[model samples]
Target: METPPQRNANMAQIFHRSTNFISRFSLFAGIFLAGLALTGVLGLARSPYFTRQNVTRSQPVQFSHKHHVGDDGIDCRYCHTSVETSATAGIPQTKTCMSCHSVLFNNVGYLEPIRESYRTDASIEWVKVHRLADYVYFNHSIHVSKGVGCSTCHGRVDQMPLMFQANTLLMQWCLDCHRNTEMALRPLDKVYDMAWRPAANQAEIGRQYKAERNIRNTSELSSCSTCHR
Candidate 1:
């Protein structure tokens, strides 16, 4: 048998650029970004967490978060309009589903549960996964106006096949983000799409809100009494 040629350990490099000048530089850049991605994944895994992968799931209706949030590119406000101004991201009524499916599907496949709900005059039982205790007052608008983006806590809904609660929905996790400004937020609306960081410092924006509200400190952010009885 003929002896096999030894493989060069470094030759496995994916980029075939022959110019050493740019090739080495590209190699380092690729490795750096790769390391960053690995670190992010590790951080998510170690931290107390939830994701569309784990949030209250198994919707009997088989609605697609990805379709609405992804292909249609519908803003959260279109359906859960209250998030911008209310405490809860109110669930879309059966009418909302029928409004679209009336002409879209023209079949009962997607609208069956909705039709049944309408016939019975009952709300479709959507299992909410990210539930905070009654005493914990969570307001959607305050977080949005304070520079918190939706994706930070909810994860990437557009990419999820089924919606899962992406955040741990725990008090500690909220506090942890409150303490760390760097990882806290992103472009205001970007939260609905994915985890995006703000181009500018969010602390400055928060300070403006502070002055507007006249609380003057992070202490005003949230207290037990603020949301609780």
Candidate 2:
């Protein structure tokens, strides 16, 4: 019943109104999400430390880093002793575990499963959480020589009930820590502090104590020559 001209005009007006409403809604939504994302990032950046990553690792024997490293006061170097002295802090051999188990495996609460594994003559399949490709070479001694501590790479291990690879441990991550003289190059005090805060004189103190403890050319921290021929 309406005139054709009037109908066309009405249709054009409706379409124009719809397009404007959609455009404005989209713009407002985009701005709101961007603002929210920026706020989250800024909040993260402002903190003294980043939020703890949401990760957990459970291993065979329920090996407790907290119990060993924190409660018993066993140093990381004791189990991973070779790290500071060798190219790799090689996994503790069965003998290493047996040494402790021989002494403590009888404790009813602690060694039940551990003894079971020993009885079976099967090594506990340790769930290695942190790993890199075979081609990437990392030397514990080199980092230790530079006064980097066990915790720097391992994260707050004393807090972990089970040992997981806490850091991303990517090549970039390695380079970042290795490159920062202000960070990696630190004092003898820095080498031991699992809970180090910070200091201005850290680098100078670290540099002063370049350990004369010669890393014996015994393949430690060396390349393929250490592992292969």
Clashes of each: 7, 2
In model 2, the runs with Cα more than 4 Å from the true position are: 1-54, 105-110, 203-229
Alpha-carbon runs more than 4 Å astray in model 1: 1-56, 181-195, 198-216, 227-229
- Compared with the true structure, the alpha-carbon lDDT of candidate 1 equals 0.70
> Candidates' TM-scores?
0.65, 0.61
Candidate 1 structure quality by residue, lDDT tens digits, 58-162: 887878878988888878778887887888878888888778877787576766888788778888898877777787877888777665677777778777778
